[model samples]
Target: MNEELAELAASGATALVSAMGTDLWQEAKGLMIRVLGRARGSRHNELTVALDRASTAARGAVDARAVDYWTEALSRLLDRDPDLAQDVMALASLRIPERPGNVVQLISATDSAEAFAVQYGSQHFASGPKSRERGERP
Candidate 1:
């Protein structure tokens, strides 16, 4: 499997899972079904039932493995239709909403040295009630 394609599957799966029972659920499900193409027909009812169950489970308390289950399902679909990788990725990207306005970030390190540090996506950092000086360590 293509690494990038696999990554897209994983990401798209998470988005689909998160959007379950939301306004985006139908849209995501449609896109996912289309991506599945002919294979979808064979598993149409099965998939629908699974998605509904997932949505119901999500609506309740919490299911930590929901994302993983959805990711695996999406991955299997991708594996079945390697040709739809790009289209699936495009659909996945569409599910991700863009953030408007300026984004701010604050990063702090204390008594630690590291190489190749990287961060992605929206994040926030707020100082606690008690402020502490960051001292450098030799």
Candidate 2:
């Protein structure tokens, strides 16, 4: 697995901790740990497939809030690297939307690290209050 991809996966999991709640966040974190562990011995394609499945399972078991966070992060990832749009689409399909209309769509997207940062920042701002009030400051 590419180091960058590994980092992204880890960061995505961390982001989920806030985007979703602690319970779901812990699940996401577990998935990331599995991914990271397998990555040490697997190839890129293998890691990708594992991540896709993990994301799918996580999405299915959580609320739309989790899916939304995953989708937004994935959308920004695709946007920054159009080459990854297919991967994003694949992962999106694995996601089982708690709400039928919560699926994210990516078409001819371009990658922008700055855009990802902005989107993530906004999401953090929106979800932070609830997390703080609940005393889950991870």
Candidate 3:
């Protein structure tokens, strides 16, 4: 696959997996089904079941193999119909629900420090003690 389609597949795969248990899961899955349903009627049921399995795997943990599977699937889907490739970006752009609270994301820096940023919910992110092991900096 080309770079654009490849990146879209990777991101959409991640987004589809991450949206598994969230309220937007159905929304995400619907978009995918709609796209695929238009082309392959026979594959509709099979894809739906596969998507559910991917969701289950994602709910436990972001399974790399599952992600790879979906990535390839989505990549081919888009390659066959480049016009529809744009929608996959919207899939990746789905926002995760946030609990109501004061989210104080603090980033402390010493004097003369260069530009810095604070982020959360990064793909493959780790929390607590394991964050360091995952190469995340505090």
Candidate 4:
């Protein structure tokens, strides 16, 4: 599973759950089904029932439990078909309307002057982050 894709799924789930109680609920559902691609016959009926039940439970509240459930659901779906990410983002953006921005950070430190590094994402570090703090690139 791709970390970036997982993050995307989480974000999309938050937006989808948030939109559940809005006038755009049907639109969101349609987008999700479209992402599913094979939502037809019994599968489609099952998804419709599940989505309706979730919407009723949400009832205009940003429920944490609902968000968590949808996050895992979307994560699993994306795991199966990563190509659906673009469609998921389309639905998410429609509801969330986020500003386009991202942040990258890296840190390095340890006790006893030990050589250690703590980092996430793609960041190159020198032998010590001290050089990085001084605007040196590794």
Candidate 5:
């Protein structure tokens, strides 16, 4: 399963790189593909940490203009890839702070319909901590 997911991530990365024509994106995608492979095979916390590092690396590779471009591209990509959309939405949910018990309330109060939809949709597709620990393939 881990191998499969790594392949999927790699394929996504490759597609992204081909579409974007940026070395940074290519490097980041390669690292992420490897990280996902390792995580799948071992289900280690260290692997998860590495994946996070890869994500950070990928983020760092983006300039302001690139960010805008990527955002637009991703929006269009999501329209074509429901799975990617779900993964992205789930990641956004994870980014939300769950502190002070008010976090839930705060999330509930958000006025943006898009935000709410993304959050709700993410739950359906986001990989759980336990599954991650077990290296269960998405």
Candidate 6:
């Protein structure tokens, strides 16, 4: 499989798993069903139920392996149904919950000096533990 397609699969799976039990659950579930249905053809209903089960598992807490499972599923689906892959990509792009431009979170920590920094897409983030700061009692 192409690396890009693999990335899409991984991203879609993560989004699907994270959306479980959130306000976006229904939308995310529906999008997965639709995309996987296109790939599964006559097996659409079966895939739908499986996706639901996975979502239910994710509702309690999402583990990294869950993302891998769904990612592999999507990758195989795309491999077998190359034509449907475009649709999957498009749906994933639009409805997988958080696209590139979405602001998923904004975290801010203030101190006299910065210890760590993360910068992405015009956003800057920094953090430092109080325990590591100077002149602080343990």
lDDT of 4 by residue, 16-133 (tens): 8877767777788778778766423334466566776875673755789878877877777777777778988887787543333555655555442335543433546565434334
Which residue pairs does candidate 5 place in steric collision? Answer: none
Cα lDDT for residue 78, candidate 5 = 43
Question: Per-residue lDDT of 1-138 in model 2, one digit per residue for the tens?
Answer: 455554453345334434243345445445444433433332435545645555446343345554455544444443444455334333223332233444464445233212223321244554432313343334
How does candidate 3 fare on TM-score? 0.60
- Which candidate order results from sorting by TM-score in descending order? 3, 4, 6, 1, 2, 5
Sort by lDDT, best first: what order?
3, 4, 6, 1, 2, 5
Candidate 3 error regions (>4 Å): 41-45, 54-58, 97-138
Instruction: List TM-score per model, in order.
Output: 0.54, 0.26, 0.60, 0.58, 0.25, 0.58
Which segments of candidate 1 are over 4 A away from where they belong? 40-45, 58-63, 95-138
Per-residue lDDT over 78-106 for candidate 1, one digit per residue giving the tens place of the 0 to 100 score: 77777777766755775544334565756
Residue 47, candidate 4: alpha-carbon lDDT:
56
**Candidate 6 local lDDT, 81-108, one digit each (tens):** 7666666665466443343454466566
Across residues 1-138, which tens digit of lDDT does each residue of candidate 5 receive?
Answer: 244344443344334333233444444454434434433323335544644554545432224444443344344444444356435432222222222332242444223222233433344636533423343344
Task: State which candidate has the highest lDDT.
Answer: 3
- Per-residue lDDT of 27 in model 5: 49
What TM-score, to 2 decimals, does candidate 4 have? 0.58
In model 3, the Cα lDDT at residue 85 comes to 76
C-alpha lDDT values of all predictions: 0.64, 0.42, 0.71, 0.70, 0.39, 0.69
What candidate 6 gets wrong by more than 4 Å, as runs, is 41-46, 58-60, 94-138
Q: What is the lDDT of residue 14 in candidate 1?
A: 70
Overlapping backbone residue pairs in candidate 6 total 0
Please tell me which model should have the higher TM-score, number 2 or number 3: 3
